[model samples]
Target: MRYLAAYGGENNVKAGMLHYFMYPSNDISVMPKEFLEERNATNHSNIGEKTLKKSIDIYWELYKVKGRLQ
Candidate 1:
């Protein structure tokens, strides 16, 4: 709590920067890019397309911002 306060006083909760302390699955292997691509192509489409697209957009934006900062 003290350390987090040093960062920004905890008044602001930034998305994509701070994640839950514990995640349901810590294994990244379960959601590989190829697997997501294949699932997205399938008829049923395991995950919702809109949700996946939004996540991808967020990643791209973060990447761009990081590159610019450096």
Candidate 2:
């Protein structure tokens, strides 16, 4: 398991978000060009798309509210 405590915002979250999604456990093989561009205004990673959608889906399922709220 891994934990991250980072500020929210485009700039503040980019590097951390990238690292999270690219972590070996996540198995993310590609990343959206726009995302990498926004990360550093350059697309040197040469990764592809569907990364955002995949990451969001994983996040939603991982952090989804389960059972009844207390």
Candidate 3:
């Protein structure tokens, strides 16, 4: 999302390209076996939750700034 904002929001061509590159369809198929195993093991871990919360907080901050500008 930050990348999208940096490239001029979701509607921009560069943002679309960035999204495609960042989230390729073959991501899981190409991942290392050990990394996949570790991710599966930590599927329900607190780290994932914390990371998600942090991302939301950042987006919220950006949203507030946008609102103020408007």
| Best-matching candidate per lDDT | 3
lDDT of 2 at 25: 27
Order by lDDT, highest first: 3, 2, 1
Structural similarity to truth (TM-score) of each candidate? 0.29, 0.27, 0.27
The model with the greater lDDT, 1 or 3, is 3
Best by TM-score: 1
Better of 2 and 3 by TM-score: 3
CA-lDDT, candidates in order: 0.37, 0.43, 0.44
Candidate 1 lDDT by residue in tens digits, 48-68: 556655654565455443346
**Which residues of candidate 2, in runs, are more than 4 Å off?**
1-49, 68-70
Model 3 superposed RMSD (Cα): 9.9
- Which candidate, 1 or 3, has the higher TM-score? 1
lDDT tens digits, residues 4-63, model 2? 233344333444556544452223323455655555332223253367546645764575
Q: Write the per-residue lDDT of candidate 3 for residues 1-70, one digit (tens) a residue.
A: 4333445543353434334334443342234566656654222223454565555456556653345664
Which ten residues in a row are the worst by lDDT in model 3? 40-49
Model 2: lDDT to the true structure: 0.43
Better of 2 and 3 by lDDT: 3
